[model samples]
Target: MNMERRGFPVWSIVAIVLIILGAITAGLSIETVPEGSRGVVTKWGKVTGRTLGPGMNFLNPIGVDVISVNVRTRKFEQIEEAATKDQQDVQATVVVAYHPEPQRVGQIYTDHGLDYEAKLVTPGVTESIKVATAHYSAEQLVTQRAQASDEISKIITAKLAANGIIADSVNLINYQFSADYTKAIEDKVAAEQLAKTEEMRVRIVTAQAEQAVVAAKGEAEAIALMAKALADAPDVLKLKQIEMMREKWDGIMPRVVGADGMSLLMTTGE
Candidate 1:
């Protein structure tokens, strides 16, 4: 019985040692905060008011909660269908680039929680798209889509900044209209193209007519210049007459047929 009692004390000491070792192990447990991320730690259901950065971080094993917020840039795509100023239904697909301010991440988490995508980002994007698009007509939306996208981006950035989120840029990925509207736009574009083609053809014909007049003027001026030159130099006229005679005669003697009893003979090389 004494031996058994002594063994009991030893077992008690072993169990105590194991318990102490377990407690130490638990206390030594640490988490790593990745680069470009901030760790928010809460103690006993209250935020600790301190943010942890990259590397191993210690926290209370029992009552502390550590939440990691990524400081890197993130992209979100938002799609919405809304009515334009002209009451035309359009679908807008937008992509937004954003990043949480590293210094403000803790506050953002506290205020927005983990589900900021549903609570803040999406709503902001949708609202901005709807509001900005509402100011433009369907034709304007199609033709000046870039301007509409810029306006929407500006509004979204401003709104997100107000809520502690930093938006880098918003891009309109695609804008689609109803099939009937698309067909109408295509037809209108075709008509405009046809009108432009007709205008171009008319311009071409007018240009051709002007060219013809200019060419005729040039020919008349050339003829007057030739006459002036020939009048100034009578030898030029004789040389031209000799060239014409050589071309008209083939070195044959001239033959004359008279019908009015008057005969005139012209000899070659005369």
Candidate 2:
């Protein structure tokens, strides 16, 4: 009886073994969580509410999933145009610093989904900027730019934290005003500078005029004192005239012709 062995073929056994090895290989693979990251594990597309830290971790081969959340600081920027309190349009470039809370990673993912950037972050930043900017006039916003940024940061930090997100800081990168408004501000500043310059010029001229008047008065006073001294001693005039002639002639003798044509000799040296 050519009874073929009813046992399974050797090739079939080998195929079964290969399939089992493949399943084991897939299940034994390790997923790596990078530094500054938190891993979230989900089972059957539902979050398991468990967070894993950085390193290699094992998850279910077919039914479990692992997602990495960035725990390090992150930055987001947006350029937005909105109306100020005075109904003037302004363009503001804003930057936000934030990081996902590691403990709340699963909840954040579940609530905001994987696209939290579009769902939560963008809207939060937009609302924060709008609300804070709406409280200031365009002029004040321009002048007190730092204060406006601080206000926006505070509002965003508070609001975002309440929703399980941590914001490190918010910055107002730049602000742009309408061309007409910018020109108006520039004109006003130029006018103020010109007025200041004119005032400074007037002050300088007034000071110079006062100094000149004082100098003239001092000279007149000195002359009057000399005249009074000469009057107190009548001979002082003759002595002053002799001193003046000595200075002018440099110790030389002079010949004076009088009104009757008589010559007189004047000796300057003793």
Candidate 3:
């Protein structure tokens, strides 16, 4: 009697197992990189210096690993305290926007790894802020804030460039000082305003006094000139009196007493 075979041939079972293993190996060899991102490929925990762009890429699945690195711009914000040029303590809100150089991402990963922001970017930004803040006084930091931000950006740009990072922008959003310094600034401004008001009042009073003196001098000169004219001609006074009488006289003539005590009628011709 022929013995019933318990299962299929041994070769068939081995073929099925081989097929499943191949399918798993094929799946492991493929890697999909998303947009705005780059895959850093490594072999046996060693950097391969080969970057993969978006889409599927095939590589040896046995010892190769892929690390996704985002190439898009990223923001880093922190509040930093620094000393100003005038030895004043100040705090600033520092924001730095940066991104890794796409072509040099492999080198960046090799040097800085995944914690590049913490290791390189943060220290670079912090040091740049301190360096820039040292150039300006606390008051200038507030008044020339745009200038300060530009300086910080330039510093960070140079600092990060060595590490394969492109610093896009740097912003100094807010500034704070000690309470005593703030009060001192306020008091100084108030004093300046008060002084300006006093200066204006003094100028107005001086102008008024000068005008009064000019008027008095003009009146005195006129009186002196009239006295000289009268002394040169005594009959000028009598002419003046006659002119005044004519202005007040009616059409009728008036009777007056002459030096000899005789009554006489005074009349003026038209």
Candidate 4:
């Protein structure tokens, strides 16, 4: 009876211990990495230069730790107030889309933790905004917003890429100035437009006056030509006098005075 009891309890204990051991072994040998993420294995807080891809991965869990890093594209957005070359205060929203290089995941995690955005991208963005804004005046910044955005993108992207981060795109979403500045710009534009209208009116008046002078000169030239033609042929003057008399005569008979001092009745129509 004692042998039976001892054997049964011993076997039960062995089975229980085997189950626990099996669970521990399974836990240590197996790991799962989620999509859009990569895992870096480390030993004693030191990276082992090994990285694991997404899905089920086997690892030596007893002496190793896997740090899962998000290799997916991430975005950082910030609104910053900066000064232009003209000393105008401008506000801009900067957006940066970045991701860690998949092959450099281990190096990235070892060098900078998952909080790399705060450490690297933020400063790069801030500095880029300042550098870009300083090169243009307030008016230029507003007028050439696209160019300014491109410049900001170049500076930030170059800086981030040097630090092992891939910046896909950087953008200046919104660029604006103070309300007072906008109002001033509007007023200045209005004044300029008014000046242009007035100048156009003046030009029109001047052109009309020039046309009148040209017409007067044309009439004077016609009179001079007529006088010259009369002087060139004295008979033309007599013919013109006869034409005037014929136009003035009506049905009444006109008296014709001859050079011999004799008067005759001239009939216009029989």
**TM-score for each predicted model, relative to the true structure:** 0.69, 0.70, 0.66, 0.64
Ranking by lDDT: 3, 4, 1, 2
Tens digits of per-residue lDDT for model 4 on 1-270? 575666666677788999999887875577788899988988888999998999998887777888999989998999988899999989999888899888888877878887888888888788879988999988778768788888889988898888888998887899878899988877877898899999999999999999999999999999999999999999999899989988986957669888998998876552
Candidate 3 displacement at residue 133 in angstroms = 2.0
Off by over 4 Å in 2: 1-31, 34-36, 43-48, 58-64, 72-75, 161-171, 250-270
Tell me the tens digit of each residue's lDDT in model 2 across 232-262: 9989898988899678876556789999999
Off by over 4 Å in 3: 1-29, 58-63, 142-146, 200-270
* lDDT, candidate 3, at 255: 91
What is the C-alpha local distance difference test score of each model?
A: 0.85, 0.85, 0.89, 0.87
Error of 1 at 256 (Å): 10
The candidate scoring highest on lDDT is 3
The alpha-carbon lDDT assigned to residue 96 of candidate 1 equals 87
Residue 214 error, candidate 4, Å: 6.9
C-alpha lDDT of candidate 1 relative to the true structure: 0.85
The TM-score, computed over Cα atoms with residue i paired to residue i, of candidate 4 is 0.64
Question: What ordering of candidates by TM-score runs from best to worst?
Answer: 2, 1, 3, 4
lDDT score of residue 145 within candidate 2: 83
lDDT of 4 at 101: 84
Q: Mark the regions of model 4 whose C-alpha exceeds 4 Å error after superposition.
A: 1-28, 60-62, 193-270
